[model samples]
Target: MSEKLRDQLVGAWKLHSYVEIPVDGSEPFYPMGEKPMGIIMYTPDGYMSAQLMKPGRAPFAVNDFYEGTLEEYKAAGSTYIAYTGPFKVNEQNRTLTHSMFISLFPNWMGQTQPRVVSIEGDVLTLGTASPISSKGKTVNSKLVWHRAQPE
Candidate 1:
């Protein structure tokens, strides 16, 4: 039998990328030397959490020279967005919908969005709805989560 979506996602995975797609078909958001990274952990008790580890400085285009040291960047941890709620899969659409009753992002505190999740071998890809930044632009963030192997 094919593995259930829930079963495939029940584990700890690291983030690979976090992109922002522009609404006007302009250049999508890509970090400078952008090594977008993060982590996601889904529990058996209908609980899920995620954290995004991003580069602190781009190629000194806007903010002059890179001020922070490499050690600082490495030490400057990532932000997290977690929630505890129910999750269901729509096999027909190949989509996984998560109903987050509580979330770290205040906006998602009481909202649910249909997301696309695909698992190929050990890689888990997740696509979310258009995320609007403070400037009100629609962007699709593609987050790749790699399964963490037990040591």
Candidate 2:
């Protein structure tokens, strides 16, 4: 991978939109709702982390994380997606693969998934290379992100 492209990606990005287009000619679904909130960060050293959540999710009845009821826990889990690990860039194909060391979704743990990547100005678009099961159907996800301003 070219160092220049990698350098361009080493920062935080804010989620702008996320949509899943089903292969079976179904309507696109929004996993995190229309106005989802998320942050994805890539480090120059190759580490990366992503956290996405549905906006306005209800708070658990209990304040403590472990004290939530089963329903609350389920709601929390179902409305969020997170993972972190090392990332690799394929310069030839203009792709990026995230090798998950940890993930909120257990099935993704230890798996490496490639995403087709494109950058236009400050926006970065990532599209799934393969269909993934979401909400009971196989679909390809397309996510757009804007570069985050430093805090």
lDDT of 1 by residue, 14-37 (tens): 866666676678777753225756
Which segments of model 1 are wrong by more than 4 Å? 31-33, 55-84, 129-135
On lDDT, the leading prediction is 2
In Å, residue 78's CA in model 1 sits off its true spot by 9.9
lDDT of each: 0.68, 0.92
Question: Would you list the clashing residue pairs of candidate 1?
Answer: 15-38
Model 2 agreement with the true structure over 15-130: per-residue lDDT tens digits: 99999999999999899999999999999899999999999999988789988999998999999999999999877666799999999999999999998888888999988999
Question: Which candidate leads in TM-score?
Answer: 2
lDDT of 2: 0.92
For candidate 2, the per-residue lDDT at 141 reads: 97
TM-score between model 1 and native: 0.70
Candidate 1, which ten residues in sequence have the lowest lDDT sum?
56-65
